[model samples]
Target: MPTKSTRVPTHASTPVKRRPGGRSARVQDAVYSAVGKLMATQRPDQITVPMVAELADVNPTSVYRRWGDIDALLEEVAVAAFTREDEVLPDTGSLEGDLREWARVITDDIVRPHRTRYLRAMVNARDGVVLDACPCWTARREQLAEMISRAHTRGERTPSVEQVLDHVIAPLYHHVVFALPADTAYAERLVDDVLSMRSAESR
Candidate 1:
């Protein structure tokens, strides 16, 4: 087994340019970047389109017209941010290793710049909207599909998406959402417990 590396990854993800429609793409990038800058120091609720626009050097009308409101902008930015994060999830040989490594990386992300804004976006996501509406959720599923497929290649079965989320991912998110102090050790324990339960259930 490959021992876990102690290297802490910097969570400063580059903002993706969303919306590929020419000037629209530029506008989206500027808006997303503006929101990211604000989110670094202020909660999403504490930010306004005017504030974002002033920081982005765009017209407030453009911000309002494109995103409609601060809530939508934050959501979009959150999804974009998560996409960047997910792009780095490693493909370790074992499903357990893959998840444990993923969890450890995100455990460090809990303290990154603008971490609170993204966590609030994720926790508040399912309150009134479809959880799948968030691009981050979709990105995670797609990544899992690939991960699971790799496990199958090694003749190993993997947990269902729901199981993975409920047992592993959700618990880590809880730490962030609740502002609890947890490190990757918490992630390893959570994964170990969940895998143990799954093994017991299978027997």
Candidate 2:
């Protein structure tokens, strides 16, 4: 938690260190907030750097210095926003239910103009830094592993985490990114297909 004075205060005074939980963190929070606020009513193309700077009460140079360009900022902010939503993996007592829910949410996000814009930007990030910066990537894989572990405990045949990702989750991501149709039914079927397959060539 941040103190009242440090909770997104203007940086016209002394500069804050860009470390986690510092003034720099507050600035990031404010900027993300400003982006969210603007995104609710406007399309991604309509959002400008100066507009975000104004909404965030920070300098345009600051925004430019940290994120490079509007599209870059959108990518970072969008990843952060979506990452927060999946912090708690779904557990509807069955893996199929959980997979379906996750797929629906992702599919819906992909169709949203604003969310998709940032996702596309991230997909084009050749440096591969954005995915590493996002906690969601690792956490999501872990959640899937946990789900498999639970099924194994129930005497059900289970695949490894990598198998699940490769056969199930990765396909859904491919569909969404490539603009293919992947609805809830498709999501459930993919999960079922993967889960039913034999692992380690034992079949």
Candidate 3:
């Protein structure tokens, strides 16, 4: 439960190095770093390959060669941000505890800062031709589904796993990240309410 001041790292972009694996890896790193920094200030729609190339000090043609288009570049940035191993929920042998930790992690990591940026990125992707093509949404949906499945296995949730996924967890994430209220006490209350519902169903 870190305060807002202490929560976000000053440098939000976790830049990966140009891997020596090959030229493609290096070029991709350049593209991701460039897009990530730009995303910090501007919405995803504002990011273009030329803008990224200028920021990364690479040729716009080079950026296009690696990523094809702005949508592709933004997709890569979303995958890197959302699908990282650290973003996955821990099993923790108890659904309630695991979900509590999950909520807290998301609250601090994704919701603390740049909430609008992340939400706008999703919106932009959805309104474009690259909706299903984005791996970020796919991975996150799978992760959420898996968490619900684990709760079902433990007999910790009711009204079907799909119900909880749709009505409970999904809505909570939407509320916390997209419609971020200035008052986080409400966020905590939502988390607690979800956890309590699962606990009650378990018994």
lDDT of 2 by residue, 18-103 (tens): 33576768678788778877876776777899999999999999999988988778766655544442235667777666766765
Error of 1 at 172 (Å): 0.8
Candidate 2: where are CA atoms >4 Å away? 1-23, 37-48, 68-72, 85-87, 127-136, 200-203
Worst 10 residues of 2 by lDDT: 1-10
Name every residue pair that clashes in candidate 2.
Answer: none
**Order of all candidates by lDDT, from best down to worst?**
1, 2, 3
The collision pairs in model 3 are: none
- Residue 1 Cα positional deviation in candidate 1, in Å, after optimal superposition: 37
How well is each residue in 99-170 modelled by candidate 3, as lDDT tens digits? 556655655655645644755576666663644333444554566668767877886653334444554456
Error of 3 at 25 (Å): 0.9
Instruction: Answer with 1 or 3, whichever has the higher TM-score.
Output: 1
Measured by TM-score, how close is model 2 to the native structure? 0.68
Cα displacement (Å) at residue 181, model 2:
2.3
lDDT by residue for model 1 (143-172), tens: 777776788799886676666677777777
Give the best candidate by TM-score.
1
